[model samples]
Target: MNPTSPFDAERALSLARETLTIEADALLALRGQIDGAFVQAMQAMLDTRHRVIVMGMGKSGHVGRKIAATLASTGTPAFFVHPGEASHGDLGMVTPGDVVIAISNSGESDELNAILPPMRRLGITLVAMTGRPDSSLARHADFVLNTAVQKEACPLNLAPTASTIAQMAMGDALAVALLDARGFREHDFARSHPGGALGRKLLMHVRDLMRGGEQVPRVPADASFSATMREMTSKGLGATAVVDGDKVLGIFTDGDLRRMIETGADLRAMKAHQVMHPHPKLVRDDALAVEAADLMEQHRITSVLVVDAAGHLVGALNTNDLLRAKVI
Candidate 1:
């Protein structure tokens, strides 16, 4: 924000390192605080049939939102409800069976405390995440997962730097523990993140994005170079497979075409098999698209032949298909 300030790499690096060391110490200290209260909180979250309603104020609220998202994506049903918003008609989001994770570094957020009595009356289980175990919020909570930090990374020791980092790390610990307890797998994670590249890599098979049937460029091994070029051009995939009945004899790519021309091979007299790569890269239709992409990268090829266990060409695909699917 200060345009007049000078930029110094060494000073910036020193400050950044100090900040990291402070936060890292805070996180390390959390390991010792993971006692019976932490286990009890995890159990309550796991046993909740409804959902985990996370509540916090200010910086704690920011950490709580990310915590809730981590829980939700990692197989726990969770959502963040701003403590300030909870009093203003957002209390309806909490139900009788739901579990509440109330977070406060001071354990005295007025808005969060304001809704606790009614929440208790509604018979909802309350778990507190606070730095002050003796504070009012802890006294009202059924279980308290203390997130106490020695001090903030801020030079003033007043900002929520180290404390917020500790809180987020604690939330991640809960998610990872619940993930293991619930038998969550990679496929389950992929299902939750279907729009992401990781999901595409984990879930998409070759058949899911391959060009099959007529869209595949194919020509007979005995076909002339002109016919092969026509097939490649029509498909616009930069490659074509030379087949003998259902079997793949060879492959001819645009690269192969260039080599043929450079060598001055008489195109009118040459056959498809004459200049084609005898052993073209092949992948199974059931193989993962990520595997296909790896194969292409390893072989330095633009396309691959998709076949079955019988070694019959069923389809084909180029890098563009993988790119469009976000698999590469």
Candidate 2:
């Protein structure tokens, strides 16, 4: 009985790397199997008027839930239904127009197979994702998308590693195909993920987070520098817009005042327009808030003017406002 050498860390890492390589190769092989049936599955889902109801058991169930979420977020309305629950009266959730995607490695999950008959009776289209094309679920399916893997990454070939990855990748393929078919745009995706950073970046318009009406720190271009300073202080935005009618002529910021004073420019003798930085960076009302943030960062400015299509100063926003809105 020779004792194992003090838990060889390097050997453990080597084995882990080998497992990852095997899984990666398996996925690459799976990609080659996509064919007409894959297209048919996507077409079936797109043609269905009701939501996609994903069903599976055990590890497949977990993967199915994630697939359902990805589909919903990408513009296909979908949800997961436990097949075991469907056997126990949850089958009522399935409707005639819905498409059912059943996931199982062997395509013979008893609980999942149990709900298929009723789903078919209700006129629901069945799309089976399985490793075995000859299995019961695949035999009954209107379309079968293969997720077969030659072997698991596990040494004993028992774990669901390579098979689960294939299933998830196939699910993604279905989602992306549906997304393209529906012409799902970035704005649509942003609407679904409004609480995420990407949503804030793409969906939020400058006008949505800008300070307008009386809250805007603005002064006439010809007003005294003292008045501009007073406006900045009263508004608490650290800057003031110098406007002439509806047009923005310049901006007077704390930095601008500092430079003006250092240049021996007398505030008492100068008008706001004379000392203000002219033609400051401006953004359109419809511009994405993230783009506004990028412009401000590029110019090293703390604030920006929100203008309408005709270049009229409609609103203003500072760094603090962007931060508050979580657009940064």
Candidate 3:
């Protein structure tokens, strides 16, 4: 009997590197091949009033879900349906006027092909993404977006690495194109991602998170330090707004009080206006909450006065408020 030599670690590492290199090159080649057919595919879906139904089988199904999510988040309404389940009644989820994006590496997944006739009969636009342009699904599609790769990243060229990456990239291209066509903006994206930190930063405004109305910790500029301290303490904001009539004159914070004490400034004789840093930084109620945070950091301050167009103090907010609102 012949004895087999032990596997070489270096050879194994070299093979892995070669696989990745080949797949990366394949994706670059795929990028150059994108043309008018891709545009037609995007236009077909854009023209439809109904949602985009993404369908695939096996590994393609996993990629399809991610593609559907990306499209939905970027202003194009889309959802994923497993091809295998479509035969068992999930096909009902698709409707006429909808766009169907069927994903298959070989373009001949039996499960996905089974639903084509019904989808066609319902007048749903079919766009196929496949490695083989001549495959059955592509031939039946209204438009075919080629996602072909010369080989897979697996040593035996069996795994779906290169194909899956190409499909994902193609999906991203479709989403961005549709987003541009629809005039989708940051606000639209924020509306879709309300639970994310980016969403909070973009969607939250000063008016939404600020302490307003009677809860505003404010004092007349002519008021004594003792009175201002009482208002700040009562409000639990660790700061008080100093105003002359409705105009914000300055702010007095816990830091200001500590500094005054260190300098032996007599609080009993001092008025709020005299001790306050006059003309302190202020933000408008309509400003993005993230901008307020930037302002606070820029001025080395913990709180900011929220004012109206005429410079009247309408609200107040602190770093703590931003933290609580998850805008930090």
Better of 1 and 2 by TM-score: 2
Q: Which order, best to worst by lDDT?
A: 1, 3, 2
Provide the global lDDT of candidate 1 against the true structure.
Answer: 0.92
lDDT of 3 at 98: 94
Q: Rate residue 132 of model 2 by lDDT.
A: 97
Off by over 4 Å in 3: 1-8, 244-246, 309-312
lDDT of 3 by residue, 246-325 (tens): 89888899998899889986888889999888888999999999999999999899989899888888998999999999
Q: What's the TM-score of every candidate structure?
A: 0.85, 0.90, 0.91
Model 1 alpha-carbon drift over 4 Å, by segment: 1-19, 244-247, 255-267, 273-279, 308-312
Clashes of 3: 0
lDDT of each: 0.92, 0.90, 0.92
- For every candidate in turn, the CA RMSD to the true structure comes to 3.4, 2.7, 2.8
- How does candidate 3 score on lDDT? 0.92
Q: Could you give candidate 2's per-residue lDDT for residues 200-317 as a string of tens digits?
A: 8888989899988888888997898778779999998888889988889988888987887798866898888898888889999899899999999998988888889999888888
> Deviation in angstroms for 168 in model 2?
0.8
lDDT of 1 by residue, 214-308 (tens): 99998998999889999999999998999998799999998988988898878878889886899888999999899999999998988999998
Q: What alpha-carbon RMSD in Å does predicted model 1 have with respect to the real structure?
A: 3.4
- Model 3: lDDT of residue 220: 98
Q: In terms of TM-score, how similar is model 2 to the real structure?
A: 0.90
